[model samples]
Target: MIKVSEALAIVAENSSNMPVQRIPVRKALGYILAETLYSPIDMPPFRQSAMDGYAFIHSEKHQYDVISTSQAGDHSNIKLNENEAVRIFTGAFVPKNADTVVMQEHVLANKDSILIAAMPPQFSNIRNKGEQIAKEEVVFEANTLITPAAIGFLACLGITEITVYKKPKVAILVTGNELVKPGKKLPKGKIYESNSVMLEAALQTIGINKTKVYKVKDNLKATKKALKGILEKYDVVLISGGISVGDYDFVKDALLANGVEELFYKINQKPGKPMFFGSKKDTLVFALPGNPASSLTNFYIYVYPAIKNRMGFSDIHLPKLVRKLNDPITNTTGKTLFLKALYDETNVTILDGQASSMLNTFAIANSLLIVPDDVEGLKKGQLVTLLPIN
Candidate 1:
């Protein structure tokens, strides 16, 4: 068996980065930047008003007269003189020779002349040219995820389109003869299928909205047929269950029979030790354990990062938190264990009765408490590393 980190490295090394494509600014949200975006023009290209106020020479004190009103998008080439003031709204361009802006509330206005009650400090209420951004400077770097704030920033820099990595198409295969579709009454030992829905939801959260799901029986012929059909259509293939050494586990055998080379199998980790990876042609396949918690945990720890990196994201790991364990938890000194935990601002508590097939506990978990394989157990209030799950 290979170490978890080493197995993860193999997956990362084999995955290919997505190609770059030009997309409209409206559709670029959640996509990763393929190239650095430089500002073609300075943000706020000209000096503008930061508030609704009067722009005038500060030294002229009470000798200022109202000349004209300036709203947003005013292009009048009017310049200010000593004792002359312009009524400027927020985001309007500041006129020349206006050194300060006195708020409207502070100015006593008459028909012709305005009496200044309080003089604002120099450069007050003014947004200077290039103050937010400079011309020809990098506004966003490559590999940065395009979020709402990033989109707004790019628009502020006058960018109408951007280059981003193409989103990967994922195909999910859930194999089991005893599994029945939802809404159907289970017969004897059969249970309703849930892995397909869970995996699809997980993929959608990371912006990979394009997905196809295939339900295959545990028979070798049926499983092999479905796997071959999906490999031709999707960029990445995720198969849940049927990878272990049991008689019904035929995923590894089918892949090898179809000319798919096994990259690695069996990581040294609990709840997901039966995970395996293989590749045929350009399609990458991950065989996750059948148990819901184990499958999801392996997907987060191994597969999700590979997909993110292939999509051109620089940061592939989830955010981690240092928290104190609220209960004592014991584990064997072999495989690393990721315990489902509930963590908030005040406390982090590990959930009791953890089984790989259970789903109720995972739904309420906010973080995963990582227990090293070398440690036998942890006492209450012990500091531990927690990885947040979205």
Candidate 2:
């Protein structure tokens, strides 16, 4: 068995970014930019009005002639003389020679002219060309994540598409003979199969929607055949059972038969000690324990980061923090413990049902307290590492 940190290092070393592809900016949310993007044009390419008011050349006069009206998306070339104002709405292109704008509420309107009740400063309420960002300036660097606001900002610049790393093609295989699908009658000695859907939903949370699930019986022949076929096409394969040394377990032997290079077999951690990570050619494989809690914990710790790394994310691990423990705890098993907990700003409370087979605690947990193997016990007020999760 290897230490948790060593396993993480191995995964990081093996995971590589996927190929780059140009996609529509609207569809690029949550994707990592594959190239540095430069602003094609100045933001607010022309002088724009910042409010729905009158635009005119600055003068000390309290009265002005209303020349014309300009709203958003208008290309009026109206010019303004001294003490002359034009009715302009927000986001409208301000006419040339206009240097000031006053809110309509601050002016007394007449039939064809307005009297300024409040004389504002020169060049007020006007967004100069490139005020936000200049043309050819770096808008986003390579590896920056695409967010909703990013898409809207790029759209304002008339950018239709952007280059980003493609998400991985993943395949999940659930192996066991005693597992039955949900909504079906369970046999006397069988349990419902849920890891496949649970893992699929977890992948979806990270915007990985292209995934297929397969079922393989607890037999070497079937496991080998399934592995061979999936490895040929997918970039990542997740096996959710049959890795232990039980008589029915066949994933480990099947993976070897399929010629996968084992990078690591197990980690010195509780709830997910029997995890397996390996690769063959370009395809990465992870075999997690059959238990639901163990399977999900290993996914968060190992598989999630690997997938994010392959998608070109620099920050691939779960968001972590340090918080005081609400109660004391002990680790007599001498293994790193991933305890499900509820955390606020200052403290974390470890919940019950830390068993590998139960997910009740995980369902309500907002974070996972990582207790290192070297630590034998912790006091109520001691600080510990916490990983925030959904």
Candidate 3:
């Protein structure tokens, strides 16, 4: 078994970025930019009115003759003379000779002229061309995460398409005879399967939607066949259950039989110590514990980062924070503990029902309090490392 840090390092070393694809910018939210992007034209491309007002050449005057009326999206070429003004709406192009704007509410309008209520500053309501971003300026560097704001910004700059690292194709193979699909009648000792659905939603939260699920019995041959088929078609395979040394557990054997080289079999971590990480060529595999809490915890701590790294993200791990503990907690297991907890910005509280099989606490958890193996426990008010989850 390896330490948690060692396991993470191994995952990082094995993960590689996916191939790049040019996709429409509108569909690129949450993807990693594959190439540096520069603005093709200045943002706002032309001088623009920031508000509905009178645009005019600045002069010390109580009134001005209205030359023309302009609304948003209009390209007005009417140049203003001294004391000349245009009735302009927000987003309208500011004529070249205009240097100031006065709110319509502040001006009293007569037939064709308006009286200014007070003097306005020059360039007060004008958004200068290239004020937000200049033409040919670097928009974003490679590996930048495409957020909604980024998409809007790119759209405003007239960028229709962007190159981004393609999301990975993933497969989930649930292995266990005791597990049955949800909504099915419960056979004496069988439990409704949940790891697949839980994993599917978890992957979607990270922007990965290309996934398929397979069910495999505890039989070694069935497990091997299922693993073989999924390994050939997916970039990553998440196998739940059948990884421990129990007589019915056959995932390890199946993986080895199919040429998956074990990089690390387990880690010194609670709830998920039976986890397995291996690779067969470019395909990565993670055989997680059968327990619900354990499976989901391992997915966030290990599998999530691996998938993100493969999608070209440099910051692949969960968002972290150093927050104070709201309550006391002990880790007598001598293994690194991942405790499901709730947290505000200041402090975290470890919740009840932390057993590996019970997911009650995990359902409400917004963060995972990480207790290192070297430490036996922590007291109330002591600061601890936390990994925030959705």
Candidate 4:
């Protein structure tokens, strides 16, 4: 087995670089931008009024003639003369020679003229052209994630669509005749199958929605046919179970039989020791151990990064930090142990149920306390690497 870091590096080098395509700005949320976004025109495209009252040149003012009124979306370009004001509402274009706007509540209104009871600072209520963004200004850098505010800002710049990297189309295969679907009666020694559902939800959290799931018996022939079909259609294939060297384990053999070359077999890590990675042409594949916690851990560490790389994201790993251990733990084996942990403002507590098949404490976990393989024993208050999960 190789170190976890080495396995990550190999997967990084082998990840597929998906092509970028133009999509509607509304559909680009959470997607990495493939190109820089520039403002098409100056924000607002005109000098605009920032308040509702009157628009006029600032000076030692008392009363002035009220010209025509202008509200938001008005196309009229009514000009203002000296000592004259125009009734203007918020977002209305500031007519020529108008330099300021006073709030309606602070002004005394009459039929012909209005008194400026409270004078605003010169040019105080005027939103000048290009105040928010200039024409052709670089609004967003390449690889910037599109947010809700970005959508609003892009709409202001008259942008209807943007270019972004495409999300991966994934196919999942859960192999094992001993596995039974949820809601069905547990007959004999069979357990409820949950890997596909968990993985599908995991993929959804990363913004992948185009996914198909299939189930196959442990037989080698059936597994091979299923792998071949999924490999032909999907960009990524995730197989749960049949990776370990057991008599019924046929994932490795099935992959090789279908021309899927193995890149790695296992990592020097606990819970997910028998993880397998492979790729054939444009389709990347992962065969995770059947244990619930083990498969989930492998997905977060290896599969998540590979998919993120294809989506053109810069950071492809879980958020990590160093925290003081709240309790003592021991690692008798050479494998690096990843313990489910709960953390507060500063400290992290390693919870119970670190077993590969047990997931009772996983629901309460917010991070994984990584105990290195070389470190056999750790005491409380020691600073250890922690990987945050939401």
Q: What number of clashing residue pairs does each candidate have, in the order they appear?
A: 0, 0, 0, 0
User: Judged by lDDT, which candidate is best?
Assistant: 2
Which candidate has the highest TM-score of all? 2
Q: Which runs in model 2 stand beyond 4 Å of their true positions?
A: none
Ranking by lDDT: 2, 3, 4, 1
What's the best-to-worst order under TM-score?
A: 2, 3, 4, 1
Q: Compare candidates 2 and 4 on lDDT and give the better one.
A: 2
Model 2 per-residue lDDT at 216: 91
Per-residue alpha-carbon lDDT of candidate 2 for residues 1-390, written as tens digits (9 for 90 to 100): 999999999999999999999999999998999999899999979999998899989988989999799989998778788968899999999999999889888999987999999988999999999998999999999999998999999998889999999999999999988899999998899999999998999999888987899999889999999999999999999999999989999999999999999999989999899988999998999999999999999999999999999999989999989999999999998999999999998999999999999988899999889999999999999999999987
Residue 376, model 4: lDDT of 96
Worst 10 residues of 2 by lDDT: 75-84
lDDT of 1 by residue, 277-370 (tens): 9887767889999999999998888888888977998878777798888898888748788889999876689897578898899998988889
> Regarding TM-score, does 2 or 3 come out ahead?
2
lDDT of 2 at 383: 94
lDDT of 3 by residue, 160-253 (tens): 9999998889999998878888898999988999999999999999898768999988899989888888999999999999999999999999
Candidate 2 matches the true fold with a TM-score of: 0.97
